[model samples]
Target: MLNNVAVAAVNGVTPFELGIFCEVFGIDRSAVGLPVYDFAVCAAEEGPLVVGDGHFGLTLPFGPERLEEADLICLPADRGAPTREYPQPLLAALHRAVDRGARVLSVCSGAFMLGAAGLLDGRRCTTHWMHAPALLRRYPRALVDPDVLYVDEGQIITAAGTASGIDACLHVVRQEQGAEVANTIARRMVVPPHRDGGQAQYIRRPLPRTACDTMGEVIAWMARHLAEEITVEQLAERAHMSARTFARRFLAETGTTPYQWLLRQRVLLAQELLESSDETVDAIAGRCGFGNAAALRHHFLRTLGTTPNAFRRTFRGPQAA
Candidate 1:
């Protein structure tokens, strides 16, 4: 039912984030039996708008009026979104869209625009991890979850960072159309058909300082030996420290506990095997140190919100799965 789509562009919009919406919805992909959207990019502000980095300017044909007919409205990240004020007309359009049951999605800092419009009030949403704190401070009522790739609150979808915008858009497609249509579009785009919105964003943490690089070596060993049973006590011995000290240092360095870090790595390994190899789930579980398919399934579902077989089908197609 989501046939009409519009991207509301303001000055200083990030080109890559804006392109995410254009690629996902604006392209004509009906040749493969996919639904073609009536899409437009509307300038929320006056013409000759400058893009991020001031590299170029855009003169859009559509304006806020185009948003009136859209079933969904997209807000891409803007360089000045954190502090800049959105146009009154644009904000009014957003409120009207949601009031009429149309969805509004924001990519990265574009959530700031939604916050300005009061659309994110009392809604659980997210933005890029770097901007989550500012978004929360600016809009105190918006529940910001910084870890996930996106948050879907029915009429409002907020995606974290850059590529996660693709995930959110495809999710909307999958919801409104079907998995086959979403998967076909993903294939055409050469990206994943589905990445769970709940999946953690890839945030890099600084390594913990150590006098002799012992903890670094231990973590390297842990990654290398993920297929084997690992214990904090054993890792502590290898690092020449007590179990408690090792656990504390691991948490400080990785921002996660040892068991959780291992579980996440094992799930990642299982995903790689599922996509690249023909190994049975039991075999993969053993290879990843899960010991059995049941354990693998439990942890995989907890971490990725999808089963191994389903993930394989998503990446390798149904016959491959």
Candidate 2:
């Protein structure tokens, strides 16, 4: 259903963020059976638009009128987004798109455009952590959560920083088309197919005191053994540190506690199994260390806002159920 896509470009648009939309939606991937969108770069302003830092200028073929036909509108970050005022016509087009059920996505400071349009009012959204305070100050009604990689408020998806834009875009593809299509595109892009929207935007940690002082091996081991029962004390023993010290170091390195990390990894593993295999919920529950289908359902609902069967059906289709 999301066949027509348009990227909205204004003055001082960041090339990298714009490229993220182009790379995700503008490419011709029909050769591999993926949906090829009717895509264009639409100029929101009349004159030649300058890219960030004045590296280059773009004379976009499509104008604001092109946005009216799009099923999805992408707003990429601009250098002056936090303070600059968006054109009224451009903001009105955004309002029309949302009012008519089309989705709008903003990458980094692009959220400012949505805020300026009043679309972010009363909606939970996010921007790059650096600009989160400004976004909140400028738009007090918007619930600006600065920590997560992205926030998906159904019609509006806001991604934090640069690379998380890829995550948010892929998330839309996976939701609209299915996991197989999303994963294939990710393989073509040489990037991970999914990073949960709830993931920390950035880890709070100082430079490593020593090259060898890290939780890399422990984290990798945890990932590989998601089916096994994992405990903080056990992980501490493996890391060769006291339980209290290990907990502190793990939080520093991972931006979450050991239990939360393991729980999230288990959920991710369960999602993969549900999508790629015809495994029963009970079977996957055991494989992902949930022990039983009821336990899996509880955790799935808590973490993903859906039950195991419902998630499987979403990705694998109703026939899967």
lDDT of 1 at 186: 97
Model 2's C-alpha root-mean-square deviation from the true structure amounts to: 10.1
How many backbone overlaps does candidate 2 show?
0
lDDT of 1 by residue, 1-321 (tens): 999999999999999999999999988977889999999999999988899989999999999999999999999999996988889999999999999999999999999999999998899999998999899999999999887888899999999999999999999999999999999999999997966524441444343344546577887788889899999999999988899998998887777898988888888888888988999999999999999999998998777767888877867998987
Compared with the true structure, all predictions reach lDDT values of 0.89, 0.88
Superposed Cα deviation of residue 179, candidate 2 (Å):
0.8
Clashes of each: 0, 0
In terms of lDDT, model 2 sits at: 0.88
